[model samples]
Target: MHKNKNIKAITSFPALKGRLKQLTLCALSGALLLSVSACSEQASQTPEQAKADFEAAYNSISTERLKNDIRVLSSDEFEGRLPTTEGETKTLDFLTAGFTEAGFKPGNGDSFFQQVDLMQITADPDMTLRIGENEFVYKVNMVASSKREVPSIELSESPIVFLGYGVNAPEYDWNDYDQVDVSGKTVIVLVNDPGFAAADSGKFQGSTMTYYGRWSYKYEEASRQGADAVFIVHETAPASYGWSVVANSWSGPQYGLVSPDQGQSRVKVEGWLSRDAAIKVFADAGLDFDQEKEKALQGPYSQALDLSASVTVNNSIEKSKSYNVFASLPGSELPDEHIIYTAHWDHLGKDETKDGDQIYNGAHDNATGTAAIIEMARAFASLEVAPKRTISMLVVTAEEQGLLGSKYYAENPIIPLDKTVANINMDAMNILGPTKDVSVVGMGKSELESYLEKAATNQGRVLTQEDRPEAGYYYRSDHFSFAKLGVPALYAKGGSQPINDEIAQYRKRMNVIVTGCYHQVCDQFRETWNFEGITEDTQLLFEVGYDLANTSDWPQWNATSEFQR
Candidate 1:
């Protein structure tokens, strides 16, 4: 129910920073000379001995252990592992114990916990939106929130402008706001980019949603554009999810890092309007929604609508602290450099309004990822010869809350980002079974794919692109946080194609749960679930990390990648 008394927390950044300096010095000093010497000896071993060492350590990733961890973490007793809740206490305790048992030293100085200050903003649902003369109810036709960290957000009769996709990508030679000034006005944008609408036209990765298509990017772009408010018209196909997801996800308590400005530079209000509601709103302004959308797909477009909108959101703000759990196996030679592995431990928590099952036990959503990271740590620790570069496991908090935890850690890193070799992120892992291939999300973004290909080959498998690249899986996970800062990140997992016909049938049944149980109460752990796929995937992660850890390679982003440093 509570953290072990042995566990300690690092309360100040100055102290944490000093500890980081101390750790770096320790890595380079005489203290680790013996460790480095041992690694040098291990590195010079015969090929057969090295292979045996790898095999023995790789086999330590257990499917049974993964399953057990998932069951325990996803149980009702954990209360969905929400940050700043009782669940967080239990989750942190579990992670600290797991890392200690696995022989990792505290990654942050003398403590395993790096405190992340967070602000939780729960928007009052009893809100209304008036676009022109048309009124829309909250969560019925629209869902809204503010990042401004204020008591209330209000837009009074703000002029509306259609700013197609709300993208400002100069590299794409596109900027919707280039011709229009949306400062102090409400901007309405379509979900996703023109790529989704015309995939074959070779416009921005063709249906594979670029960062420009992401709602978060849109909001950020709008804030930079000085827009008072921004609303994205939600179409299920383009958004990669239905309106229900938007409503449910946006309606809940949102967590953000405690900022100095309290999000003063952000747009006053950010929201989603149902497609039907958007259509009606456009029609009310005497604009044909389809025709306008078509114009948007062709090129940069914007139009001042003959209407204005009004809305007020009263926020119930609560400032609290969360954490990013860190466990490190200091490398033999390059302990100062890090191969960071990340997974979010926080979920949707519970919804008391639900009749029967109130707890949203996010078993598949993240419990699997959390378990995999712990196992990966265990495997690395079991190795007779530690890696040349430190392998650090960061079980971040509040991922479901807009990747706040990872974002915080990335911006304020314990191990310097420049010194961080590469990031390997695991979120909802495969539950169906082993596959002949692993699906690499945003496959072409990094050189890490080469390492992954080699690792997968060892398993007699191949690496392939994810099935739904249009979903923008790359930008949706914790890896994106590191990637945003130019760190090459790999987010790949088991493909949909099962290894055998028997597992293929099992895949069909598992697909229902995987697809439907996202962020729902039905996302609880089931004994019938298969762990072979995730286990193999975990081992593959180990292989790649092991290789990176043993070598002096610093993985780089592809030259064409937006994140290239």
Candidate 2:
């Protein structure tokens, strides 16, 4: 018998009162009925038995084991787990060992590793920008594009065009590229969509950023137009984060696909400039940066300013190799078909600036997520009845580096695309506390919603929409890579409301975890971590994978979804 005393609630608050009452009544009623239904008392189990089985599996997930793994992975010794470093070897070895111990067979036959060839471009920190004798150093104001390391590129005194949102969506009948030729010059644009500015705002989906509004889209569009360079002006509200975050994020070594079939990205240089620095650049050219930004926000606006600027970026490029660890549990009936569970194993690596502390040990960001998959593998392996389809447990690399691992996997899948049913991705699990609902990041975008609804229902939970859609989190994760290829991918939700607490306070605490610990050193493990929520989340995910693995149904894309058509 499992000990109930070990499963005490971590905190006591008011919001859990209703949920506790409901759970108690349901359990009691269920137990009584289950007791009566047993024709032979020895042959039947009570409702508590079922719940207890789930809880035992949940509680069996040792937070200490998770913490120990994280402690080593994130410790300075691991060197931030950056690809092409000693840490990569250590991380991969650790993951493979864990999978082997969990009884998962080699996913890629004869090997547990998937070799990903990549190009690493490390740019010089001392890049110089000069616009007709008006010069500004790189770090102080602007950063160059990640595409290539050009020692020096001259920009002929060309006109600077202001394009609204810089998006072209024929479906929405909106195009920032309409009536504008940005060839041979730089284009200035805003971050996110106009809806973000006013909610009911612009020609584009008001505050919600369309694909065109994404910075990556803007750079691609500029490249297609044969523009010299692209500069995106950064603001917190519109961009969803501060300039410091962007600067620190892009300053490190970046990764890109190194396949024979990959097409060239258009723009030679693509990057961002701080609002203050942009103001100075505009001022030097005798143009008003604020006015230009405001005009760019309005629809169908286009203007050319003679802001002749020249930038010289000096950097070194190197090619390196990364690995995506894979393991599988083959199904009984449809052995070839698969349902993938993905979690990124890489983090920011090490930053020497933080005194003696260095390793990024992505515990909550993904180590927790990775561990969840391992536990799920254990659960599925324990089932008496084997699934009808194969289950692939994928730990991708370079997610923090820009979803390179997943993107690589999508382009070159070990399993054919058509046979792959759904990609269930776990980026960061909720370590906070249990809540009334599980939040879906990109809610209502696909048929995966229906699948999640069924899974949540089984756990006595409900599905909820993302709390901050403006953040554009759906486009930020490894799942988006698979989604881009028309694969139905599900990113599972973590605990939001505490098992016993005020909903508002729980929300506040949740935000703190996302903002403060998300990409920081403070994300390390704790002795006080209840792991109750982790256990619940892990069990819920196993149920989802089990359902997908056993059922013959193919999860489809929603009709309204952009990927469906």
Candidate 3:
């Protein structure tokens, strides 16, 4: 959902929030140039010109309609749009009505909903973690969870191992796990990568983060090592979020992609420890935590720590149900092939314990995106002739719980993967007015960039590469669920190029949103909010899908992309 520059640097999207699963942000701008080279040669105009002709129709997507959708969806009446609650019923009904009004059919083969079976586990109070003689209080000193469907997970006095960056990249000749067996230990790893500390572009893609730096990768690697637990050390600078984010995330019910074996393959304990707590643990073991951390960034510094830790987690879990909204505008020429648009409709729901306003009211966090997708559905249906490839719009649930709904859709796609053309995902929509460039989260990963570039040129705007590769925004979104299965996906945000002399103001806006609004109760919409940016980005995306729907060409991941597999 969001990306950061690197652990040490704050370049593009630095303050981007990492929610329960890092739900993401962004937007774009510019105007198309029109020319009259020949008064009599209208048919010979360029493809750009052809799209310019249709620009008016694309612009027909009124801001009033967009505002209306956001206003209604994010309203307190919906109860923050949580899943398996009254919110789910109201949201589903609203979406189904919108799709039906737009002349779309149920994409789930005779049903407007796609069933996703999930298990919700709420961590009970009094969770305990002990390191040597020091006991780390839950939420205050440590936080943990297990994906496995069990009432409790208890690890007795597990040995701690220090894994440098916890990465095993053969291409980079880096294997932090070498020369040691971590079969039954807890791996203590740093956030981000060594390249971030060195500020050298040559080291693990320099400041831009690769998949290896993501926390998800750390846990996966731990599972591979047959470790009982994985604890990622959280530093404000490197992690791009404060301790509060972790505390809030780990305090509640967490959901996972329910496995056939009830996540039997996942690690028993995955958690985070505050930097201060990690430092204390090292000092108690007679090691200088700072010196050890410095060695971690110096390259190839993996060793076993002399610390022993114990973890215990008890959960009050209940089985729950959620639905993925799938509706389609069937293509005229090749209805079987499809172009999909996705945006998650679920937020943190409502938190009654929090003081002041308890409603998370994710107006901009995702109501903007969810509303925008439905608006696009309306536009596609109103077209004089249907697009060549079917346009499927998906409003998924439980993205806040780690892209669960999207993952389910990818694993159990209503349409076969082979026939799916491409996917375009919209996270938080741009609210910072118009700009000169559009931000593509993974610009060079696939041939879809060319299509996006073409559309940008048609609108007289340039493409901006994702500024925070370190944040792993590309892997954080719902689109990633499709990309892992070989589908070329474009997950992007509005560009940073502010129009007029508003660069400073734009930065200020992003800072406020990043620091305060994300996943917080203050994320509600404003009456004075400028939605033109969201409108422009939506239209640009519509044009991209419109082009792909009408063309026979298929988008492919670049040869260098890891997802090419």
Instruction: Estimate every model's Cα lDDT from 0 to 1.
Output: 0.85, 0.69, 0.79
Q: Give the TM-score of candidate 2.
A: 0.80
Give the Å error, residue 514, model 2.
9.4
lDDT of 3 at 38: 11
Task: Please give the range of 10 consecutive residues that has the lowest summed lDDT in model 3.
Answer: 19-28
Off by over 4 Å in 1: 1-46, 284-286, 351-358, 512-515
**Candidate 3, 378-484: lDDT as tens digits:** 77766555666888998898888788899999999998999999999998898777768999896788999888888888777899987866667888889999997
Instruction: Give per-residue lDDT, candidate 3, residue 271.
Output: 93
- Runs with alpha carbons beyond 4 Å of true place in candidate 2: 1-79, 131-136, 149-152, 201-205, 259-264, 276-301, 351-354, 502-515
lDDT of candidate 1 over 1-565, digit per residue (tens) = 0011111222333322333211221244554443322233344557787788789989989999999999999999999887777778788878888887777778888888888887777889999999988899999989989988889979999999999888887778889999688888999999988899999998888988888888889999999999999999999999988888788778867767889899999999999999999899889988999999999999999988989999999998777777899888888778789999999998877877779999989899899999999999889877777778889999998787678889999999999998999999999998888999899999899999999999999998988889889998788889999999989999999986788899999988877766767777899899999899989999999999999988887888887676773
Per-residue lDDT tens digits for candidate 2, residues 1-565, read 0000001112222221232111110124445532111011224335576455545544466655655665566666766666656667677777777776655777777577787776655666776666556666665667775475344445556567767677766655667789788888888777887667767654545555555567877887888887878888888888888877777656655556674633244565677877887777777667787787677666656666566666655555656677898888767668789999998887776666668655566677777787777777766654333466888898998787678899999999999889999998887777666666788887777777777788788778888877777777778889988988989988767645555655446557656655666666677755545555666677677777767876789988765455665
After best superposition, candidate 3 residue 99: deviation in angstroms? 1.2
Ranking by TM-score: 1, 3, 2
Candidate 2 clashing pairs? Answer: 74-361, 80-349, 195-206, 195-207, 196-207, 223-267, 434-497, 435-497
lDDT score, candidate 2, position 379: 65
